[model samples]
Target chain A: DVKVTQSSRYLVKRTGEKVFLECVQDMDHENMFWYRQDPGLGLRLIYFSYDVKMKEKGDIPEGYSVSREKKERFSLILESASTNQTSMYLCASSLGGKGEQYFGPGTRLTVT
Target chain B: AQSVTQPDIHITVSEGASLELRCNYSYGATPYLFWYVQSPGQGLQLLLKYFSGDTLVQGIKGFEAEFKRSQSSFNLRKPSVHWSDAAEYFCAVWSGSSASKIIFGSGTRLSIRP
Candidate 1:
């Protein structure tokens, strides 16, 4: 089975603090994505990496950035955490095809 | 711009009752649609997908979906929903003639009441 693992299942950060969420996929997929899910708002894309060192902003990339230094791992960074940035962050990876994506367990970030 | 919509925000059904979740899309060309389920505090799982070919497609976990081009909709259905089937269902669309980015619906929360 394809497996995607996230660094933390839950995290708490103070305002203006930097936060990092890491994700690793064992399937060697070409595409990885970061999304923040909120009640009623659903899963909104934050950023996506198609290849190493390549990143693209998604619908809600304002307070977030992403890193793809290696093929197996992707990182999401919140330059300065804010109260509004708290949400359940999800990481997903998929092959080049238009097939289904495999997602990690998710990191619930709480900004205080 | 391509987009997806799930009309219902939440649905309640008794265990062993039939279930159907509505999804609609707006895209210039034929779109690739998918249904995903997410249990509480877990990542989403793919339930079914509609790319081309047959309109009715069977998927994992006793779930199925039908794609209707005329209505631009892909609705998921289950003959008998179990209690474990309670989860959030999201519908996504990608209009990739060659390549495409996915756009997801707000999602429908399924509540199975016994």
Candidate 2:
């Protein structure tokens, strides 16, 4: 089975504080993605990395940045957390151009 | 424009009843379609996918979906529902000709009635 693990299942941060969500995948997939899911809105991609040190902005990337220093891990950073940033953050990995993503358990971030 | 639409926001059904969730897309070309299920507080899981060939596709946990090109629909179905089947379902779309990012519907929350 493909295993994707997130650093934290739940996190709480105050306004203007920096927050980090880590994810690691064992499948050696070439693509990694960060998405924030909300009620009614579903999952919206925040950022994605197709290779180490390569990152692309997704639909809702304004308040978020991502890091892929290594192939097996991807990190999402909220430079300054805000109340609006509170949501369930998910990390996913997939083969290059295959489009089938394997998701981690998810990190529910509460920005207060 | 919304690439994918799941018309029903929430659907409730008895344990042994049939279920159907609607999905429609506006993409120009033949698209790759998928159904995903997310249990409470968990990440999404792939239920089924339709890339090409057959229209009717079987998925895990007694779920299935049918792809209709003319109607631009890929609706998910199940003959019988179990209490464990209550979850949020999302429909996604992508294509060889489109960008790498997949478009997902808003999602439908399924609830099982006692």
Candidate 3:
């Protein structure tokens, strides 16, 4: 089975603090994505990487950035956390950008 | 531009009652349809997918969806509802323009009543 693991399941951070959310996939998928899910708004893609050192902005990428340093590890970075940034962050991995994407259990982030 | 729509925001059904969740999408070329279920506080799980050929696709947990090109809909259905089936269902369409990007619906929450 393809497993996608996130570094933390729940996180609380203060305003203006820098935060990093890590995701690792064991399926050797070439594509990794970061999305923030909000109530009624669904999941909005923050960023996605098709390969190491490559990234693309998604619909709602204003408050977020991402890095893909290795094949298995993809990281989401919040430069300055704010209350509006509080939401559930999800990480997913796919083989070639098609088919089913394996997702981690998600990290619920709360910024105060 | 492509988009997905799940008109029903929430649904409730008694156990053993039949259920249906509607999904509609808009895209120019051939569309790749998928149904995913997200349990409480859990990640989304692939329930089924419709690429081509077969319009009726069976999925996990006794769930299935049918693709209707004319209506541009892929509706998920289950013969009987169970408490375990209570979850959020998202309908997504694979954007052909990209290699691995998908447009997801707002999601429909299913509730089960005993």
Candidate 4:
């Protein structure tokens, strides 16, 4: 079975602190994505990477960035954490087709 | 340009009762639809997807969804509700282009009464 793992299941950070959320996928999927989910608004895409070292901005890219150094790993970076950024962050990987996505157990971030 | 809508915010049903969740989408061309279930504090799991071909698609956990092009609706249904099935369900659709981005609906919360 394909598996996606997140570095942390729950995290608490102070305001203005820099944060990193890691995601690793065993499957060699060509595409990786980072999304933030909130009540009522649903999951909004923050960023996505289609290939190694290549990234694209999604709808809600403010205060968030991504890095894909290896095909199996993608990282989401928050330059400066804020209270408004507290939410469930999800990572997903998919092949470059009309294929289903495999998601990692989300990381719930709480900013104080 | 593509979007998805899950009309129901919350639904409650007794065990052994039937279930249905509505999903509506708007896209210019043919749309690829998907249903996903998320347990508390967990990632979303793919329940079913419809790309083309047959409209009725069966999924794991005794779940199924029907795609109606005329109504732009893909509704999920199950013959009997289980207590373990209580979770948040999301409907999503793919916007076909070079980017091929997927957009998710607001989601519907399901509650099963024992």
Candidate 5:
């Protein structure tokens, strides 16, 4: 089975603090994505990486950045956490084709 | 721009009752479509996907979906819903030239009643 694991299932951070969310996929997929899910708003893409050291901005990339130093891992960074950034963060990975994506359990972050 | 719409925000159905969740999409071409289910606090799981060929597709957990080109809809249906089926369902589409991104619908939350 394809497994995507996130660093933390839940986290609490103070305002202005930097937060890092890690994700690792064992399937060796070439594409990885970071999305923040909010009530009513649904899941909005934050960033995505197509290849190692290559990344692209998604619909809502203003307050978040991503890193893909290696093929198996992707990290999402919140430069300075804020109350508005509190949400469930999800990481997904897929083969770069007509393949379905596999998602991590998710990291629920609370910025207070 | 490409987008997905799930008309219903939530739906309630009794155990063993039939269930249907509506989903519509606006895309320039025939889009890659998918139906995913997410239990509370968990990641989304692929229930079914429709790319081409037969319009009707069977998925895991006894769920199925049909693609209607004329209606621009890909609605999910189940002959009988179980209590474990209570979860959020999201309809997603891939319109990008590459499989780099997918636009997901707001999602429909399913509630099961005894």
Candidate 6:
């Protein structure tokens, strides 16, 4: 079984703070993704990394950045967290071919 | 652009009752379809996927979904509802390209009554 683990399950930060959400996968998948889930809006992609040091912006990449220094770890960074940035963040990994992604337990972020 | 739509926002069913959750998608060419379930405060879990060959696909936990090309729909079904089946169900689509991103639906929250 593929196991995806996140660094934190819940987090609270003040406005304008820098926040980091980490994800690690044991499956050695080549693709990693970050998404923010909101009610009635579904899961919107924030960023994705296809390989180490290679990143692409997804539909809603504003106010967020990603790091993939290693194959097993992906980190999402909020340059300046705002109240609007509060959301349930999810991380996923998949082998490059199949489009089947395994997800980690989400981190519920609260930006006050 | 690829997109998915789960029409029902919320559904309630008694335990042991048949269950069906509607999902519609918009995409060009043959698309990759998937269904996922998310428990409260949890990440999404893959329930099933439809790539090709067969229109009907079986998924985990007695769940299944059928793909209809004419209707552009992939609706999930279960023979009987269980208390554990209560969760938010999302339908997603990918354009079949290696670099294409998968789009997810708003999701339907299922409520099981005992």
lDDT of 2 by residue, A1-112 (tens): 9999999999999999999999999988888899999887889999989889999888899989999999999999999999999999999988777477889999999998
Alpha carbon lDDT of each predicted model: 0.91, 0.90, 0.93, 0.93, 0.94, 0.92
Give TM per candidate. Answer: 0.97, 0.96, 0.98, 0.98, 0.98, 0.97
A1-112: candidate 6 lDDT, tens digit per residue: 9999999999999999999999999998999999999988889899998889999998899899999999999999999999999999999999887578889999999999
Error of 3 at A78 (Å): 0.3
TM-score, cand. 6 vs. native: 0.97
Per-residue CA lDDT of candidate 5, range B1-114, in tens? 999999999999999999999999999888899999999999999999998999999999999999999999999999999999999999999857475478899999999999
Candidate 3 per-residue C-alpha lDDT over B42-114 given as tens digits, one digit per residue, 9 for 90 to 100: 9999999998998999999999999999999999999999999999999999987454798899999999999
With a 3 Å backbone cut-off (N, CA, C), the pairs that clash in candidate 4 are none
What is the DockQ for all candidates, taken in turn?
A: 0.60, 0.56, 0.73, 0.65, 0.72, 0.65
Native contact fraction per model = 0.53, 0.43, 0.65, 0.47, 0.63, 0.53
What is candidate 1's lDDT per residue for A11-84, written digit by digit as tens? Answer: 99999999999999999888899999999999898988888998888889998999999999999999999999
Query: Which lDDT value does model 5 have at B92?
Result: 94
Evaluated on CA atoms against the true complex, candidate 1 attains a DockQ of 0.60
* Global Cα RMSD, each model: 1.2, 1.4, 0.8, 0.9, 0.8, 1.0
Encode model 4's per-residue lDDT on A1-112: one tens digit a residue.
Answer: 7899999999999999999999999988888999999998899999999899999999999999899999999999999999999999999988877677888999999999
Clashing residue pairs for model 3: A97-B100
For candidate 4, give the lDDT of residue A96: 75
Interface RMSD of each: 2.1, 2.4, 1.4, 1.5, 1.3, 1.6
- lDDT per residue, candidate 4, B1-114, as tens digits? 889999999999999999999999999988899999999889999999999999999999999999999999999999999999999999999867444468899999999989
lDDT of 5 by residue, A17-88 (tens): 999999999998999999999999999999988899999998899988899999999999999999999999
Looking at model 5, residue A37 earns an lDDT score of 98
Residue-level lDDT of model 2, residues B3-107, one tens digit each, is 999999999999999999999998877788889999999998999998889999999999999999999999999999999999999999873522256788999
